[model samples]
Target: MTKEKESILDVKLFKRLFQYIKPYKGVFFGLLILVVLLAIFSSATPYITKYAIDESIETKISTDFLFYVVLMFVVLILQTVFQLLFIYYAAWLGQNLVMDVRVKLFNHLLRFKMKYYDNSSVGVLITRAVTDMERIADIFGQGLFMIVRDLLAMVVVFGVMIYINWRLSLIVFLMLPLLLYATRIFQKYMKRAFEEVRNEVSNLNSFVQERITGMKILQLFTRETIEYKKFKTINERHKKGWLKTVWYNSIFFPLADLVSSISIGLVAWYGGLNVVLDGAVSQGDLIAFIMFIPMLFRPLRQIADKFNTLQMGMVAANRVFKVIDTTSQIDDTGTYVAEGFKGDIKFDKVYFSYVDDEEVLKGISFEVNAGDTVAIVGATGAGKSTIINLLNRFYEIKDGVISVDGIDIKDVTLSSLRTQIAVVLQDVFLFADTILNNITLNHPEITEAQVQQAAKDIGIHDFIMSLPNGYHYNVKERGVMLSSGQRQLISFLRAYVTNPSILVLDEATSSVDSYSEQLIQNATDKITKGRTSIVIAHRLATIKKADKIIVMDSGDIVEQGTHEELLKKKDGYYKNLYEVQFLQEEVI
Candidate 1:
């Protein structure tokens, strides 16, 4: 469960929440008016009944009794009309409020730095956006406003009972202290119970999302039984949390009903004696007190449950607002737009770390001149990818300046800087969409013909034509419908279509077969021509034609030269790497 502190009935949080309703104030006020009208009609019914009975008890044909019955019937019809309108408008307001919140949350997420995503769980975020937002909608639909209406009805009923007979009203009022005490205790514990339940729900969602996404790995390792046991453990916690709330409900509601029944019994016993012995209370007044007792206590009973609903909604809103208030985003304060960029990139004594004091790139400095292709060759975890990520400002550098064309890249707008660069990562991610949509990413400027031409230029047009619908063929979630090599080809086509000024291939061809590698190599040459390029590769043979080679090891550049220049050294890092990889390729 999350270790965050649970908040109860936070007034400031509610004050902040009401800001979302500002746009729909007219609908909100109209709903309140309906609640008041409904309460008046509903609370007036028993008094009308008392009037009809008391006036007609002495006469067989009293027109006053007949008139009161018709009046009560008309009141019911009006109450029903107001109730219908209240339900419809309340739901409308709730849906509109949630839609606004969901959009704002999504927009906030989009601006967040990649570091935020690195530390956050996908399932938790999804729960905040989808599940938690629904709870917030319940605040308007069935939570705070509904509680208001019920309490208003209770107040009116209590006032009418006092008007009918102050003596019987006192008996009913006496029952409140006991039920009120019970309700207070119930509300306190129920808030804690709801917090546990919501935490458990988030935990379950996280576990399920992770397991399903990695199901292939689990099955390959034959750990299904082990995973199943883990799942059962999490599910058990969720069940326990819910059962605690159920237990509280079972205890409190029955006690409330008992107290209500006791109030009616007391009223009957006392009022009947007065009617029979002293004539202090009439038969109509006694009957009206019975009706009023339930009306007064029912809302009291329901308010506890409804208040819990309000508390849960508040909890959900707190979690979502935390995300919206997050400051983990790249500062795109620069207004300089990189139009017709020459792509002269430089990293000058840069330092970076994903975690505090654990540097991944240490005082590394390099430059890529206009139209030059620079290849970075290193073993795994040698800070090759870190350099690419820094160049794109996916993360802020710890202690250095990175510049493009002699100006700090931080001074350039993120959109303009990124628009000129196209990257093909080793692990390509495609949406559950058609090939054409994935390639263009639904950009209005890039037409289908442009994508086809780019595919043809990259030597993968025929491969695409072989699919079911060519460019229109769906590549399920994360492009699972295609093989690794085929996905890489699609990624290449995506990059080619962008016409970026600088091209980056982060081990793009490493995951593919020899045939796909050859195809990607051809595509690489076509795109990198007359464009500054950075290629990180484990395969030394693939980058033989690079304008320059920077060999890195343990977060530092150990050597920098061309392939032939480095190979001439008898004891050089690149030479040793080339010899080992050459022999390994031959063995394979």
Candidate 2:
């Protein structure tokens, strides 16, 4: 993972993020008005204090003192109201903005081809969707608007200080160069540190997700200590990344404080001398200048912090935009809609590769007539499963035509093409959901009775009923609550319930027990009755009844015929495979 160099203040990324804010311009503008009003009221406070001291207290004018008090009170109340409004509106805008980005990111992910998931990390995507989005929201809710308010306050305060006495203002401005230099160094170091932190966070997420997902593998192989050591290494890297940010903060913030203190001390020393020796500055002016020093420096310090928030938000936006800007989605310019496909499928000189030039399927051609049952058998990496992938257009073939009912699959809308075909893959994936919901996949049109009937038809209804909640049973994550056999049975019920025009079972029953296999074979008979079916199987005997058997080896079809017909070919590939693979299975 080579890191891309990012600008500390990425203007382009911020511009893209602001597009999400466009929809809520009214609220955004309201926030801006509130920020300006808050700044005006805040800066007015010191001036009111100065006037009360000089005009009312010094002159012993009771009425003038009371009037100034009332005015100050009013400004405080308005400032409080503005602060409240700012907090509320900022939250609302940030939440809505995050919602828009999250929805768009998810929809973009849905458009990605299966190859994207194959190459991308699930945990990293999860971080982008969940964690990175929250960071982006902070830019709106806590970072940008606060920065505006602080900056406005500083500008007004500085103007007031200069109007009171130019010499003191110049003294205060002299310390700013030191602060600015320190901030520049801090920003450069922190930007690199923060980017590193984000990368490490993503790395940690990916590692933990995979480790947890494969915990069973680790434990079974007794590699827990090894994995723990690996986790520690990643965790330490994450810690180091964060500590770099901390180290810069430790250096920069104290430097900012030292400069702020020096500016204030200079103002006090100079203003006190003028008041005492020359009588040029009033007591009120001295007091007001001291108050304005903090007011001026506060925003500068806060701006540095807000700049951090802004920088992080830009980083997050860059990552999220990268995902949204990806052009890897399947081309869906196809306007053809497949309605009630006739179940005929054909592969014409197909060629494909998961990676460039490393073909997985090479000029492979086959056909299955409507109502025919075809079985594919091959050793691992022999392109048996790749055929299933190509048929469904999960990956596009570099050179080929896959047609359903004589229409190129690419010409038809993906939704319609996929809706008519159901695949029960070898590794069944079930959500952490109720059994019924998993079966119907929350399809509104699939009624409870239909699900019950489908389960009964598949001969697994009794086994399901044996559970505490039966169809309502929670399968937990990835159906971990159920046995592998039970999960497979549920997958079968899910596919059967869809009642697809074409069915594909890719090594579906390869790892199940005999009882599960019997139920699967029985369900297979019911499900494949009138549909175009393609079965990729390692257990050759299970597919012996298939109308046609295509034997594959190293991305080429070496044999094709009915089971008995292929058996009669003496030293044929199918016969050799059957003896070497199936006979060994029988012996086991």
Candidate 3:
């Protein structure tokens, strides 16, 4: 009932689909040639049938009939050959077109920002990538070819009918409007039913993916029965939706058949009456008229079916275009970045909000001199992460200038600006790839020795060597094959390999065991030796060696000091955090 309708299937879909066939216009010309040949041969068939019925079988000694029969067979053979090639070319064009579309759509998806990924569902995205692409292929391979073949056949059938007997042809075509009205009615029902079917299928796919990914959580909570019920609900909905679609399609075919049968019956009865009562036409002419009746409506019927398929394909196009329609809010409009930035960062009265009314970062100002190590400490949701995110230009600032080396960040190309910075996030993400490859995600040309050196610096090289494949060892999705500490070690290596000018680590060791955390802290101290760094944590021990500690509360900086200076101030927030952390550890 609720539809997020826009022109997702606008001129763009047609333009893209057309561009795919631009190289194959020769194929289009060939298809047209085949259509015309098939039409001429199809029109000849009724005459061949009429001759057999009224002359050869009725007269019993016609030498010319044998020659006509042989000629008919030759036409039949030639048409079959051309039709086969027509189908082959159509299929080739369709397969390649869909493949191109999939490649383009996927690459476009990669260019989008984090906010785009955050708001979308994985199941819907996956469905667009695969199932919807298949639908467009169907349109090219079968739908377009079938409609063309049927239409040309209709044109030939009509010319023959009028030449044979216009009165009967006119009477037979009276039922055409009835057929159109019937399709309009059925299409309304089918579209809504099929839309529901697609949605249900998407739900089932998402349910399976989530259950597979979260099997551990489900088992931990002992919710196998509850999950089973949820799966059954989605599966049954999909089943019911499909059954409804089948029911509609099944009735649809029969309705067309009934209309066709009635029209054919009327033509037969009238043509027979003219012969019996008035004798106004020859036996051969009556036979030819009878043959033309089905030829006319069969194509018309096929045209309806292909139109139905077109509507279905358009529905899929609409879904795929939704992703294509989404604009990247964080747009890059500048030339390449300046070759060397001094890493002098400033947040000048910065403001940002995820939503219109709820400000995530209120008016705040800060400065970090080039090569300085600054530690940010705050309560949860104190906008510490927001400050680092803005500096990297990940989310565009709502107001004020965030500058790097005194140049507005918005003026630098996003890719160029990011190349000089490295971020070590609280949540470590590693691909299902070799350990060596994960470390050098961007700097792929780096040697194995370089990878090992970075890992050894982080105190993780020895552990990687302990694995069966050493540096070549494979990590599972999200590095699930490794322990929590191993994942953090790999993430740190990924950052270090970049040898970035600016380093920002956000709770980088939050989930690691104490032994690994200490190793990481020591490694980080070395990595940040000369680079401008913003280290966000409240662990107290991690920030003790920082050149300056920034204490923030509710989007405002409350204190700024060195570790010993902050500890000397008994009433400061930094001292309170340090006391709480030390006391908690002592209790443990």
Q: Estimate each model's TM-score.
A: 0.97, 0.97, 0.88
Worst 10 residues of 2 by lDDT: 1-10
What pairs collide in candidate 1? none
lDDT of 3: 0.78
- Note each model's CA RMSD in angstroms: 2.0, 1.9, 3.4
Which is better, 1 or 2, measured by lDDT? 1
Worst 10 residues of 1 by lDDT: 1-10
Please say which candidate is ahead in lDDT: 2 or 3.
2
Regions more than 4 Å wrong, model 3: 1-16, 52-55, 202-211, 223-240, 268-292, 442-444, 447-449, 508-510, 586-588
Q: Give one digit per residue, the lDDT tens place, for model 3 in 231-330.
A: 8888999999989878877887788888878877887788888878986655766788767767877777777677567656667776777777778757
Candidates, ranked, lDDT: 1, 2, 3
Distance from true location, Cα of 359 in model 2, Å = 1.4
The Cα local distance difference test for each model comes to 0.88, 0.88, 0.78
Model 2 residue runs over 4 Å out of place are: 1-6, 584-588
Leading candidate by lDDT: 1
What value does the lDDT take at residue 167 in candidate 3?
A: 81
